[model samples]
Target: MKKTLMRPVGLPESASHPVATPLMPSVVYASDTPDALDAQYEGRVAGYTYAREGHPNADVLARRIDALEGAEGGIVTGSGMAAVTAALMGLLRAGDHVLGGDQLYGRSLRLMRDDLPRLGIATSLADPTDVDAVAAALRPETRMVLIEVVSNPTLRIADLDGIAALCAERGILLAVDNTFTTPAAIRPMERGADIVIQSVTKLLAGHSDVTLGWVAARSPEDRKRMYDFAVTTGMTASPFDCWLAERGLMTFGLRFAQAQATAERLAARLADMPGVRRVLYPTREDHPDRARAQAVLRGQGGNMLSFEIEGGRAAANAFAAGAAGVAFAPTLGDVGTTLSHPASSSHRGLTSEARAAIGVTEGFFRVSVGLEDADALAATFEAGLAAARGA
Candidate 1:
């Protein structure tokens, strides 16, 4: 189901008319894109059938993102789930198998663990940090390798080149959720990633305002398969969401660099703070995948930085509660510093055993750096650290 464009409910800023209502599922021709419609009529049908199958704003935005990713084309979906579900549903079927990384987003994990098995498809999870473990998990019936470019909460950046190479050798499809390491930081396709799935709600939009998702295919076959699945599944982002995403993108390169710079600064300092026992930043020398991250990325490490506090989960919670200026928000990639307790929020769906296997301890706190002044954000952390120690 496509999400309604969540504009303020009371009237456009220009009018005395009542607010923009949640559009009916009824196709009200997107009011914003007149020029694209006009262009389509000129001499170029572009072989597009309808707005759901193709639209100007969505197509243009997808192409722009595709350029950044160096892919053939992109399929924009209503949510990240749509992108994932469509990718699998289009390519896999009953009796097929998947070799997936263990530290996936809770929703994706649930799809594989609870749903796929019900449909007679089998899946195996393994440690993506170890390239050999990934290869070992594959079976003859395995058709897909699903993994995040960088694992959530734990911030486990995968060895994309190795995984890609393994998949290529075996004629398997490698689908990477490029949400954390957006195209600005790393173009996974260049590192051998076959299908790059993205949650544009994050770094691409660069703000918390819009909800959108997409998948870019590195080859024409992948694009055709993805589009066929997406249109039939009836999952697509609205033109309004596409518009906001496109607007947000105008400043993406600039915002991504600023946020990441501050995040790296904070991650380094968090190491010295009393309650902070471990700081996980891709750029940090101690990070296990430092070499791989450097090899695949075009820019600095991203805005997200995870740390484990000295007192463990309790201390982490205390610090978050004590912080000022930054909000204790559940989401990332916002313009304000947002903190999340992964054990409770992003990784909540996993079984206790599964969570333990991935090292998602209660002490973990993932901080998403924003556009705030780095000094002020650092002091906010200092206060939070002091409060945790004093507690």
Candidate 2:
């Protein structure tokens, strides 16, 4: 597995071949005959015609991810949001209903709540942690159930296996956003998810320098439909981003392991801090979904966690102002430890009441632990907490 993910495919193994796969930025391919070009377009031959429609670099990246996720096929997208939009729009019709986790990424919720309704698609938000709640929210018109394996900001772990079983029984499509726990931690397809969504801009890209997304479908029919939608809608990723993401995937397991270790240490220390009103991490014994996380994520709580300060937004802002080393970044899964205020950032689109319903408090601060020394990060956090208390 390591060898395949780290090494580039579709290239020769000879010494003449470059150690790294060279980028093919060709927008169009040449053909000896019109019939050859027609064959390529008709899927009779393997080649590239246009960069937007399809490219060698993107194809290689998608195949690698498909193998990693144990999916029948996969495709790359311009960005994470594009992947999400394509998955929903391609799969559902006007009258179809969707049951989505209430604690999803704020922008995703906005898309479903605001845009989906305009298209005549109905959406229902429910607590994914409660299997019964999710089951109850399902209707005869429901077409899909979307949930994140580990929710953003709050780090809530849903029962992927249980949900999969329910969806299988109900004949509903199960789509999992595996961004938080990449294939390195969990393969949603193996857990019976019909579709697996990945924000390659996150851990899969590792450096935060690349913007890309991928969708893996368990069925070939779904893959073809999604690919057709992507081609028609022009939701394509640049070859450079695809190449960079492939490079990042080489060291993904290593990076994820280190970051996860630091996160575990920080979660433990944060729980004991008097300035913290609550710490929400899946691996924590007090976590609402600890058992589920253990079963699905194999005891890895992931590298992201959230904690609420004793004071509300005031303390969170003060900590952000006082923190050292950690920057206030809007995105996570970078190599450096970073902080995010969900109440004002990722979950800002949701109303205050809506945010509260999912445990996103005013004082809540989510941190993406990086590959830094755990002790140093703890010291920096301690100083920031002191400043928050003082403020």
Scored by TM-score, the top model is 2
Scored against the true structure, residue 235 in model 1 reaches a CA lDDT of 85
- Across residues 88-151, which tens digit of lDDT does each residue of candidate 1 receive? 8777899999888888877888889889999988988987878899988899999999999778
Clashes of each: 3, 0
- Give the residue spans of candidate 2 off by over 4 A: 1-15
lDDT of 1: 0.81
lDDT tens readout by residue for model 2, 80-129 = 88888888988888999999998787778988989999999999988888
Model 1 bad stretches (over 4 Å): 1-44, 47-50, 351-353
- List the lowest-lDDT window of 10 residues for candidate 2: 1-10
Compared with the true structure, all predictions reach lDDT values of: 0.81, 0.87
Q: How close is candidate 1 to the true structure, as a TM-score?
A: 0.86
What TM-score does each of the candidates earn? 0.86, 0.94
